[model samples]
Target: MKDHVMRLAVGSSARGWRVAIACPRDVYPQDSDSSRYLLEAGVKLIPLSLPGRISPHGDLMAWAGLIRILGRLRPRLVHTHGFKASMVGRMAAATFGVSSGYRPVTICTVHNSIAGQFGSGSRAWNLAKLVEKVLARSTDGVIAVSRALEREYLELSHPSAMLVTCIPNGIALERFISVPPGGGGGVRLPSDVEPPGDAGPPGDVEPPGNAKPPGDLGSPGVLKPGRGPVVGTVARLIPQKGVDVLLRAFPLVREAFPGAELVVAGDGPMRSQLQALAGHLGIGARVAFTGHRNDIPALLRTFDVFVLASLSEGMPVSVIEAMASRVPVVATCTGGIPEVVEDGVSGLLVAPSDPGQLARALIWILSHRDEASRLAQNAFEKVTSRFSIDRMVEDTCLFYQEVFRRKAKQAACES
Candidate 1:
């Protein structure tokens, strides 16, 4: 969610929009690095005491806060991302519509499918669908990050699906593209495309794999010569990411690539458990838990293969970054992954939560260097051509204009 907002905010600012961000105060503290970054980027932050869960009092407080902010800003449009923000932002826009008889355009970007996060049969998931159906009337337009996510939403029979515009997530291409073949190592993009000096490294990744530490995996420069392959993934240590499956699969991968190293990036609640599982499998030494790091481009360059063993995703930005870095990808076939990775073409895809298949894919990528290189080249070309920050921003700007045009047409018809 932060990535989308950061990219859009930066891109939108470049396009001459006076963009101000209103976010839950608790979620994004005023003095936090992220908040400071946005402020420095000229995207003003309006922190509100928004509630995390469904509470009548909390909801009332949040809605009132939004109303106050909107009333003061008198912005022409209110853009929201994710489920909660969309709900609150849409409600506030509706309230303004009722009182002033002029609703500011409300645009929403749904990051994931309702069913993907919560199971299809879950009550919360079904209730969310119902709510989306009800609130979508207030939304001027909806943006789905991928076609698969759009289809998943439409399957719920929500009319909002008709209103959705598909736009795949894009990264600041020059960030990854500028890095040297081996790592960042002082390499730089053209002056025009370079990001601010303080923007820092993006989050780097992948799921867990097993092996006991021969001595201390944390120790630097401890690896033997010809450590074989280094497979990396940049993902939160969470169930949805399927790190556990990666851990289970590592043992089999070791059988083929004996000195293979698994680099798991990102940190989450499941870190301790995942670590224990790795130690239990005697592959802890082989697995490196990088926690959360900013040197993702550098990490990608070090990887022999990049893997994303996710159970669900809505066009993962990490995958795109890996592709942009020209690393061969071995990702699980789930959500919008198939849309991005063409099996045996751009990259290899395996079934979600299948350890055996994942191991095989990783092994193939490591063993067949030529095939992997071809696949990586194809992926790099595909992402560079189709998924650049400029392209995403242009599409977004066009969508916003389309929504305004549609609204104007409706007003004329009513009159």
Candidate 2:
């Protein structure tokens, strides 16, 4: 979510829009990398405490804070991201209008499916749907990051009156596409934010002692000469990401290629549990659990095949990054993944939570170098043509204009 915001905010700012972001100050501390980056990019930071979960007190406080901020800023548009922010932001926009006769063009971006995250028919899902239906009446427009999410919004009872569009998430292609096959110079981070040493947490396993450091790899997917095939993924260690499913499938990958290695990058609450699961599967020594990495471009160069075992996703930027890096992909056919990866063309797809199917896909990619390269190249071309950051930003700004024009016409008709 932070990445999506950073890309959009920076891109929008570059186009000469005076943009400001209202975010939870506690979550992104004053000294955090994101705060520094946004400030450096000339984007204003409005510290608003929006709770992640339901809290009557917190929600009330957030709504009040938004009202105060919106009243002061008096911006022409109030664009919010995710469920919680949308609920509070739209209500504030509506309430602020009643109090001050000023209403901003309110827009919300749905990055993931609420029902998909909290299973359909569940209490949380039902409440979320109800909230979205109510909020749809006030929202001027909505942007779904994938077609799947667009369909979900259209099904809402009140969205018929709202402008809902699918705008796939995009990345800065230049960051990933410029790298050489083996990995050109890694993406540089702010000096204060760069990870120390090899960029893994303490006690994290390093590559084989004889291998070259990650910075000096000779070929894509091979850390050093004589090392085994490397299968890697970058996902938060959470249930929704299905990292456990990847752990179960790794043993099968080792069966076909004994020297195969698995590297799970990124951190979350389930990190310890996943590391233990790898130990239980007896592939502990072969797996590297690097907790939270900022150096994705460099890390991706060490992967023979990139896999996403997510139970759900909304056009995952990680997969696009891998494709942009020219790495072959194997991802689950769930949510917006199928839309991103054409089966057997750009990359292979497997049913979610199916270790056997996932293992087969990984083995096939590793065994068939020619086919994998073709798929990787196809993916690279597709992403370059459709999902560039410039394209997304331009499309978004156009939508903003269309919404404003429609609102103006409606107001004039009433008068």
Top candidate on lDDT is 2
| All candidates: TM-score | 0.86, 0.88
Q: Write one digit per residue (lDDT tens) for candidate 2, span 1-415.
A: 8888887888899888898998888645797887788788899988888888879999999999999999889999999998888888898999998899988889999988887678889999998888888888888899999998888778864466568889999998988876666572242222214222221112222222121222422222222345567788999888989999999999877776676778888999999999899999998877888777877887887688999999988879999999999999999988898899988778888888999888878876776666678889999999999999889999999999999998998899999
Give the per-residue Cα lDDT of candidate 1 at 360.
74
The CA lDDT of each predicted structure is 0.79, 0.81
Task: Indicate the worst ten consecutive residues by lDDT in candidate 1.
Answer: 196-205
How far is 407's C-alpha from truth in model 1 (Å)?
0.4
lDDT of candidate 1?
0.79
